[model samples]
Target: MGEGGKRKSRQEEVPAPPSHRILTADELGLLKVSEVPAGDKWEETAAKQRWGLPDKAQGITRLQVHCPDWDPDRCLVAAARSSGRVTLHAGSDGGDVGSFRAAPPASTSGRSDTSTNAVQALRFSQPEGSTQLLISAATLGGHVSVHRCPVEAALATAAAGRAVHTWEEAARLQTISDLQAMDVSSSGRYLAVGGDGHQLKVWDLEVAGKAAMASTTSSAGPDGAAAAAPKAGEPLFAGKAGKPSRSGLQDLAHVTALAFVPGQDDKQVLVGTAKHKLWLYDMRAGRKPQAELVWGEGRITTLQPVADGSRIWVGNGRGHVEALDLRQAPAKLSMGHALKGVAGSIRALALHPSEPLIASVSLDRHLRVHHSTKRSSLAKLYLKQALTGVAWLPPLPAAAAAEGAKEDEEEQARAEAEEVDAAEEEEQQDAGRVARGKGKHSGRDQQAGGGSRGQHGKKKDSKRRKQ
Candidate 1:
């Protein structure tokens, strides 16, 4: 700074602070980024940017996607939260489309318990060649309710002051004491329920509907009074509890998850238990399980069968997700390739509709996508909260896809223009540096020329003095 007798800048004179400062625990916690490791920072940022902020209340408990036949262009995704709320999101962009309360209204005379009101299971069904969508929701208190709404009108928004089309309660029933798993048959005619009581019960919805209709009809009794109505919650088939000598207990193991095999006309159901066992039951056969498979990992948590009914995916409590070949004999059913890289228990697993891809959510706060055939990780997103459920949204419509492609092309063009502008600016800077270097050399040459002239003048003066 003192080489040319110029004053030093204040910034240069003062020393800079250290690059990094130590933070306290409270400070780090307040930032909320402390839990994210350096290697996962990019994934965390990407997930947040795509899905927005994590929910402030309880996390999501279940996810279901429905694509109606009447309107093939629009798809809806239902998310059941632990806070006893069910919300619908647009499958295309994951935007909140609508929401409706799943739990019944609380009683005026008694306090309501939130834990008992939480939804334990959810399923969507549509009858063949029908325009209505049936949504079944099961609560922890063993109450199951089915609601119906027109599939085409489900996604339409209402005017500012008008009422919107909403789901109407079709039927309600009471099942086991602590309902844990439920599945509706593909035809929307049968429902299966199981819980902590180790009892599996199947209900014929067609029969229940007929009974409800008959009860509504006015009938004369023997004493000129109306006849009594029959119970609508009675199950058509109920499995008996296992003997004490079988498991050293009076009851069989509790069911934790349930899935019906696809392409089988819903005749076969897969039941998973807390005892690390898988049970295959045929509806035509007796209540006994036709086959059983013991898993090596922790208890089974979720089950999903592929479309062709060739294989089934099982997620366990030990963070292992494996596929089992269903074509093999029940006694010889062996585990297929297992998806890796999960550190926590998988809470849910979903297969893509058309692609050979599978998605899973785990207690590790991650949503991972894996290839079904290669069993390799395709993508991983680090959500801030522990993920409980994940489902694939339907593909975008053709018109929407084309519009998105056009927008992407515009964005690409804009980025290329910006790059070209930056390159030109850099080239100008290089030219300016060359010009400045030439000016400096010219100044030095002029000074040297003046020195040479002065030397010549001194020599001439010496010669004149000698003369």
Candidate 2:
């Protein structure tokens, strides 16, 4: 009851009640699936739509940004629909930015691949020392398209026309079947693409960057370097996600998820397959997978490396999360702790860069975000559609992050200082006890000497009496 309590505002006096919005079954039924209508009456339009269920979320990405105008709590999510279209959604109330169709290229093999419009995967990559955001999308057809989007321009266009940049490929990495999983190296030096046809392709970034740079100089576009065929550098090497762990070497299965090990020069990768087996594929260590992590259960839907590559967060089709430590042997990888998830198969999982928060999506049409270390649920958003993929934005800056948490460095320093003081106090106490023990022993010795002298005097007195 100090100055803060005496204030008339009473803002901090009473804990603010949790604010919630109530939506009827009807209101919850329809959310705007299309563009923001003219005059922008859609906040009501979404509430009034007839269709109860919404379009499925097949793919999603968050446009990375660091600015003062943007709200730190709000996130921008772009969801790809089954209709071969991509929509930029700004949170629950953040109106749709815009939508654009991702057209597939005409097949060169004569047979037509019309499934190109169905975007199977969506990801954003920003190479080191670059400001432009590169969005890569892979469709059901063997097509991967990279779009160079500027944050200001994309959002401006999205606000003005309710549509963002028209996606044009900066570099094309064609696969045999629909690409299932793709990851760019931390350094943006390599790109790994895995697909349904058991095809694994790695693209060298230096060569691709030069190619992208040349193309940009000629046409002015942003690009992601490490994810495709050898247009300029290393030739595309093919491998498999197949074969038993003990059966020597064979091809690979349909790769469902991918993760690049984190390091300045970490070359190893963790590949999750339809067979529920995790493979450590190291290109530098020969063609065979470096190790295989198998548990013999659900298909791996998403993978996230944490604890600086020593730990990995694995989500399966069964809607469960497994925390696996890969530093152990492959057999030990099966020993993992489980985290509760959605009721259905998990489609994607995105771990926070600095925090223990992990955002995940499920076929159950919900975004379940949980704390990795605390074994607790954080937020659950029932996205109206069945979600297929999810991406979390990069970690916030130190100053912005401070709002959500106290400075860990300060805490660590205080703890260390307390430990040192405690140790010093303990040593001082031991020395004091030793000194007291010596003093007691000296007193006992003096008492013993006095007793001997008294005995001698008593004997002399008895002799004098006898005389």
lDDT of 1 by residue, 1-467 (tens): 57544554632342221111111001011111111122323233232113334554545567677864323236666767666667665545445566666665565557777676677888999889988888888778776667888877665422222224567777765566688898988888788888886567888877875665466343545666433223355788776543344558653659988888887777788888888777787777777777777786587888888888889999988999999788964556778788978658878888867678787777786767778999988667665555566665443444544554465568778999999999999999999999999999999999999999999999999999999
| C-alpha lDDT score of every prediction, in listed order | 0.67, 0.57
Off by over 4 Å in 1: 1-45, 48-58, 68-73, 94-97, 155-164, 209-232, 241-251, 329-331, 395-467
Q: Model 2, residue 253: what's the lDDT?
A: 60
Q: Which window of 10 residues has the lowest lDDT sum in candidate 1?
A: 22-31
Model 1, C-alpha of 110: deviation from truth (Å): 2.0
Q: Clashing residue pairs, candidate 2?
A: 84-117, 98-162, 191-226, 240-252, 241-252, 241-253, 242-251, 242-252
lDDT of 1: 0.67
**Clash totals for all candidate models:** 0, 8
The true-versus-predicted C-alpha distance at residue 244 of model 1, in Å, is 7.9
Candidate 2 regions with alpha-carbon error over 4 angstroms: 1-76, 89-93, 96-101, 106-112, 151-168, 205-235, 240-252, 264-266, 327-335, 378-384, 390-467
TM-score of each: 0.68, 0.59
Candidate 2, residue 252: the lDDT equals: 49
